[model samples]
Target chain A: MFNKIYAFIKRDVTIATSYKLSFFLRFFGMFFSILVFYFIDKLFGSTATPYLMDYGGDYFSFVLIGIAFTSFLWAGLKSFSKVIRRGQMMGTLEAMLITPTRISTIILFSSIWSFIATSVTALLYLAIGGLFFGVDLGSANILSTAIVLVLTIIAFSSFGILSASFIMIYKEGDPINWLFSSSSTLLGGVFFPIEVMPDWLQSISKILPITYSLDAMRLAILKGYAPAALTHDILPLIGFSAIVMPLAIVSFYLAVNKAKMNGSLTHY
Target chain B: MVNTVEYSIETKGLVKSYPQPRNFFEFFRGTEKKPVTALDHVDLKIKKGEFFGVLGPNGAGKTTLTKILCTLVLPSEGEVRVNGYDVVKNGGGVRTSIGLVSSDERSFYWKISGRENLVFFAVLNNHSWSRAKERAAEVLEIVGLESAADRRFETYSSGMKQKMAFAKGLLNDPQTLFLDEPTRSLDPNAAKEIRHFLSSLSKQGKTIFLTTHNLAEAEQLCKRVAVLHRGRVQGVGSKRDLGRMLTRGERLMLVVSGLEKPGISRLETLSVVDSVGVEGLGGGRVRLTLELAEGSVSTVLSEALKLGLQIHSTRTEEASLEQIFEKLTTEEV
Candidate 1:
């Protein structure tokens, strides 16, 4: 299993490095987006949003954490389906499916490199925020932040595997991608606090695992909340992972069987 | 109790059907679709260490059968077992016991070198990193790609890409190998080289199930073959047995000069000749093809010489594998 994970990471990194320009361009793009948000935060000054006071009272810090954590969430949520789709297009999916490894192992291993790359990007976001934008994280509870990040990744990966199941069966035009992308970005508090939304929308946001993940992460990273103090957010994220992971796994198995029966396993 | 099965592959009444959309607007109308049967009912047994060929034209379910045995696709009905493990219930066992080399060329990571691709697949099959690299190197050498192993796959020619694919299949040293048109896009020399490699592998006690449109290659490489036509097995046996099945009598071709009407009439009158065809060669030469009953070639020739026909050349012709395949498949269609 460890060998397989290393092989997948090596393969992806080799391919990524082959396109040197694209490799550098991705980081450049992320940095430019951060600069845009930093300038916007400068224009808004420090006393604008009162909701930010609960976290760090700095708009740039609030939005930087939000952007960085949501980028991590996006990577975890889309990596499985993206890998499946790319495998189908490249005609390697059937080859991978015929191996002795379990389907769940293949799916999980395929996404680990993406998660690691996203983690590095998230750290870069934090470094830029601290150095150039005056964002502070000196008092953050590191252990609590790590726990929230791990839980959030597990929870979002479950959703990603479910989305990949749809791609495996449908082959094209998977509605799961659009549904999750729109709903999660709009209500998961990536750009702003869900508390600012209408009452009914806030109720909807409460149901999303990403909403709780962002909330817990901000509390841990910005306000230095301990694990015991953030049980309200951590419990739901854990529950979501525990329940959704198995369900998504079962759904992925069924989708693979369906594709096999229909002789569409390799069809793109 | 353990089951002891002699055959490497066994399929009884295996059937596979795929659902087809009713029409272009079926999705909008939500209409019920129909199923198209890819394999009607295939029953086969391939012995251990035997080189078996599945000969068929396009759309003959050869690929479907291969896929089912490789455990990449499921049979809609009946049972399939590879290495004595049920394909549906114990797919992992089947996968571990076999490897597949498909005709599809896009199955590799084009950006990576051939060695990396093989190593990656080897690790996926549960090999350690060191073992995977070792196995990849060995297989690349076996497939005559050792020098080109480090070249990116997209830079390789079609035949080189195919050899790389073949090397990947051999990475695990599987007991049974499923090759679907392994030489489809190769030049004649390259195709011959691959065939020789497969023949050597068969000599090493590897069971090979090869599907090919090239009848001569199958005839040269396989000990037993099954002819598939329209998702059905039309015939299965050695080349001689299939030929005899299609043509129960022997065929003899006679080239003669100074053939006359009386000579033809006399040859037709011979009791051993079942049928005779005469084509004029326009230079006082004629070609006579005589279908004779068993053990009648000598009698026919003697009778022809006594009738004043000067025979320049007499040759016996058995139906080639291509002829047998065409006859069997076309007759069924």
Candidate 2:
């Protein structure tokens, strides 16, 4: 399993680096996003701090963690299906499927590189924010942050697996991907606190795991809260995982069989 | 179920059908669409170490049968067993026991080296890292691609790509190897190389199930073949067996000289001769065409000589696979 994962990551890394400009542009794009937010932080000044007091009372720091962690959210949500979509277009998905490997394993191995790149970029966000932009890292509770990140990824990955199920069958334009993903960016507190939303919108936000994910992440990383104090956020993330993971698995299985029956496993 | 000891693949009343693809407007209108049958009530059994071919024209369900046996697709009805394991029930077992060499050339990661792609697939087969590399090298050597193994797949010519696909299929040393148009788009020299490799595999006691529309390729490579047309198995047997089944007898042309109508009448009346026709060459000689019952050529000729006919020339015609395929697939349902 480790070999498969390593081989796939290596395979992707080679392909990704082969396009020299695109390879460098990913990091360039990462910092470009940070620059825009930094300027936005300067413009807002201290106006947003009142709502951000729970996360160190600094807009830049709060927004930095929000964007950095949601990088993981997007990775967990989009990585599997994106790779699958590319595979379908390139005909590599059928090549992998004909092997003895399980579909779940193939899904994991195919996209492990995306998560790794996300992790690297997320750490760069932290390092850049801490060194140049004055974001706090000294008070971070690493264990609580790890637990929240793991559960957050699991919750978000359920939606990804569901999205992949659609790609496996339809080959493109997976409906729920656009739905949950856009919903995450809009309501999951990646840019602003969900607490600022109107009460009805906040109610809708509560159902998305990312809302809990970012809330728990800020408390643990900025305020250094331990797991016990983070349970309120952790519980909902767990709840989302329990509900959606099984559904995603079942949907993926059905989608695969449907494609098999249609004789379109290799069709795009 | 295949006995597993004597047979490598067996299918009983196998059928597969796919739903017609709907357009955007049709999907919204909720139009009821018909399913297109790809394979219809096909039955076959292939012995262990036997080379079997499926001869078909395009859209003839040859690839569908290959996918079903590879467990890449499931049959809508009936049973298929490969290497003693039911394809739908124990697909993992069947997958582990068989290799598939597909004609689709884009199946590899084009940006990666051929070696890397093979190593990746070998690992998927559950080999250790060291073993995977070793197997990759071994198969690369087998396909005579060792020199090009380190080059990117996109750099390969068509022949090299086909050979790379063939090498990947041999990684696990599967008991039964399925080749779907393995030489589909290759040049003659490349096709001959693939055929030679396949012949060597067959000589080594590996069962091969090949699908192709190339009649001569099948005749050269397979010992027994099944003819698939319009989603049905029109005939299944050796070339001779299919010929006998379709024509129902042997065809013989003979040149003989005898004083006319009475001899033709007597020959037609003989039990071995199904029908007889004589045409005079205007020089006291006639061309006698005879359709003899299966295995009755000797009997008919022996009886002809006893009747005091001076035979000048004789020729026997056995139907070619192409002719038999044409007759089987093109005849009205």
Candidate 3:
């Protein structure tokens, strides 16, 4: 099964490497997203700058981490769904589905492929965003931040798989995928603190795993907090992982089994 | 020609169904409709090293049965065994044991080279990278695509791509090969080359199960053939056995010199001839065709002699597989 996973990842990487224009677009897109969001923050009367100063960090640094994490994680999850959906559209879905390996393994392999791509973009984001914005690049808890990022990826990607199940079942009508990609970015505190929202929306956003991921990321990068300082956020992220990962995986399993039972596993 | 080896693939009462749309709404909501029988009680046993051909019109359940045996699709009802393992219970083993070649050229990544596609599938089949590369090279050589191996698959012509697909199927050196219309859209020369390659594969002790709509190709390559229609096996046996099933025997065609169109009745008056058909007449000659009952040629000749018809030339022709197929598929018996 490791061999299968390895082959699956290798296949995606080979195909990804072949698309030079798309690779460049991914890099440019990551850069453009940060620039766009920074200007948007400026237009808000630099309301966020004084907030970051009060927290003893540059406002640009605060939002840079946010931009990096959200874009990177979003790209990782989207990569799996986009590539797999492309395979389905091209009628190779049956080929992938019929393989003896578990469907989760295939999804995992593809998500990891995208995760690597996202990580490269994140590194470039740090380099260019730091140089241009003159933000003090925080590294007080870099290792712990990296670990949380990894766990957050695994957690969020599992939910992405669940979203994929929704896609498989509904076929084509509305753009549920767009709803997934953008909704999470907007609601999960990628650009601002959910505390700034109304109480009801804040309560709803707190339940989202990305809310905790963003909180922990801000604490680690801007607040000079160690892993121990992240206990309030870390515990919930772990809880979200425990609850959502299995739910997502089981949902995917159920989706595939349903497809098989209905003879729709290969249906376009 | 089949070798003297044993049977490798055997199916008993294999049946499969796909959901069929009964109405427009059901058509829009596909897979919610009534089940359409794709394979209805198909029983086939293929001997090892045999070049078996499955001939059928479209919607004849050829691909359905192949997909079932390869474990790509589940059989709604039936028992199938490939190399002694049940397809449903031991699907992983079955998948690893058999190779499949579908007619679709888009199955592989178009952006990757032929070698990359082979290695990817080989690795997925649990081979090491080195072993996968080695196997890819070997099969590429076998399919005569060594020169084009480095080029991306999208650049390949249909024939070259087809050959690469064949090479992919052989990556595992599978004991049984399921080829679904393997040479469907190729030029005649390219198709002939593929047929020759298939013959070589059969000689290597590979059990080949092929489906084709080309009757002449089947006649040239298959030792035993099965005809499918309307989700059922219409006929299944050696060509000789199928030919013998036809009641009409020993069709004879005569190109007589100095004969005219009016000779149709005189030819029909022959004692043993069941029916005489005048195809055409040209240059003071007639093209006469006769369908005779078994062992009736002698009586037909005597009757023709008695009629005092000039017999410039005569010859007896056995029924071709095409004729036998046409008779069986169209007629009741």
| Chain A only: TM-score per candidate | 0.96, 0.96, 0.86
Clashing pairs in 2: none
Off by over 4 Å in 1: A45-47, B1-4, B22-24, B28-30, B255-275, B282-286, B292-313
DockQ values, each candidate: 0.80, 0.71, 0.36
Q: What is the interface RMSD of candidate 1, in Å?
A: 1.0
Global Cα lDDT for candidate 1: 0.87
- Candidate 1 vs candidate 3: the DockQ winner is 1
Ten residues in a row with the worst lDDT in model 1 chain B? Answer: B1-10
Stretches of model 2 off by over 4 angstroms after superposition: B24-30, B255-289, B302-310
Compare candidates 2 and 3 on TM-score and give the better one: 2
How much of the true contact map at the interface does candidate 3 reproduce, as a fraction?
A: 0.29
**Model 3, runs deviating above 4 Å:** A1-10, A42-46, A49-58, A91-104, A173-179, A257-267, B1-6, B21-32, B248-316, B328-333
TM-score of each: 0.93, 0.94, 0.85
Q: For residues B270-333, what per-residue lDDT tens digits would candidate 1 score against the true structure?
A: 7777678988887788889997776789998888787777888999888899889989899873
On a 0 to 1 DockQ scale, where is model 1? 0.80
- Candidate 3 CAPRI category: acceptable
lDDT per residue for candidate 2 within A165-222, as digits (tens), equals 9998888788878998888899988899888899999999999898999999899989
